[model samples]
Target: MDKSGNMIDKMLTQNGLVYKIPNKVAAKQGPAFLQKQRSGSVAYTQGVAAEQQACHWLEQDGWTVLLRRARTHRGEIDIVASKAAVLCFVEVKKRRSIEEALVSLQPAQQRRLFRAAECLLQKHPYWQYEEMRFDLFVFDNAGKMERLEDILRQM
Candidate 1:
């Protein structure tokens, strides 16, 4: 078969026509795509590890973690924990340094977290608590963790 005929055959499958990139095209773009994929995977892994460590710390401190990686229509909450009669919505940040992690949470993100917490409270009326607060948990690359209580009130 000619080159065009062979290409057409490669694109066809039992289910339907599938667009298969020719080797030449893939070879030209594969390196950049692979690099991005690797970086994204690394970031995701690090974030998960940080969250796990944060949860462990909370548990050790006699806090019950109600949720981790909670999703709402407004935004995502990293952690939701309770101690005594207080409920906390926590935002976790891991960076090269504690300073970097502290600065990572911007005003816009704070607003989003507040909205997400409100959504969560409305969705689950059974979560009884005398007080609710927003907390910031920052972690450095060296495994140091710092918890800032009532972060919104501090601001």
Candidate 2:
């Protein structure tokens, strides 16, 4: 309908209906703000869904999950759980395959997770937990979860 012969688009707003220029122009002219917003929303939702799945699996295994998305200056621990008398700091990595998930936690990530566990211990002095362990939950592309090694003493 415009001079370029492309159909003009309309978007609804609380104020009223308004015309929106085609996305090609803005995407080509400057930063893709809309795309970034959409991508961020998608990533956040995916993370939450994965955490929920991990929590469900942990509960089914008789672990009392205390917290999720636990963050510190070091990094974010996906889930914190207590089983028997031990405290567990968990790192969850989701990938398309077992090999991908195994390789997901690089050396740098391991260091961050280590620091986060120390921070957790510092925060909860009353925990008096006899054992502390770092565990990894690997989720495949189909959303199947499996427990890998408990990399506590390895540190």
Candidate 3:
């Protein structure tokens, strides 16, 4: 721990009470992060709705969803599904068109998603035997759904 953190621990142990010293940078950035974190008030509500729609559709399509919104230090995976020994990691995006939605998932983002998937698999060894696949769920402007299976096949 840092010197300040050690000092805080020492003072708390001595006094049998703890007082927090707020981080100035964190305090300055907190409101924006808090606003984004609000479940009902976040600007990402549309994206969340789209992901929910995709999850429902996946269930209907006979996929066993294992995780939703799984995260790692690298990035977040929207959904994880499995069927017949195949594990799918999904990316859900809503845009005006299928092309636009697919384009939105940039190459850099794809790498991060892959890294996140690796992290999840490492944490759960039971999943190691399954064949991993990357899939995309694109919600079009007309409220239509398009599923692109095995997206990373081209990668």
**TM-scores of the models, in the given order?**
0.81, 0.72, 0.70
Error of model 3, residue 45, in angstroms: 0.7
Tens-digit per-residue lDDT, 1-155, candidate 1: 23344422245455776775455544454558768889889878999999998899999999999999999999999999999999999888988999999999999998899889889999889998999999888988899999999889534
Candidate 2 residue-wise lDDT, 111-153, digit = tens: 8888887897788777757888888887777877778657755
- Relative to the unseen true structure, what is the C-alpha lDDT of residue 5 in candidate 3, on a scale of 0 to 100? 44
TM-score, cand. 3: 0.70
Off by over 4 Å in 1: 1-30
Which candidate model has the greater TM-score, 1 or 2?
1
Model 2 global lDDT (CA atoms, 0 to 1): 0.78
Task: Rank the models by lDDT, top first.
Answer: 1, 3, 2
Ten contiguous residues with the weakest lDDT in model 1: 1-10
lDDT of 1 at 56: 92
lDDT of every predicted structure (CA atoms): 0.86, 0.78, 0.81
In the range 21-89, model 3's lDDT, one tens digit per residue, is 545554455556656668435437778989999999989989888999998888899999988878999
Q: Pick the candidate with the highest TM-score.
A: 1
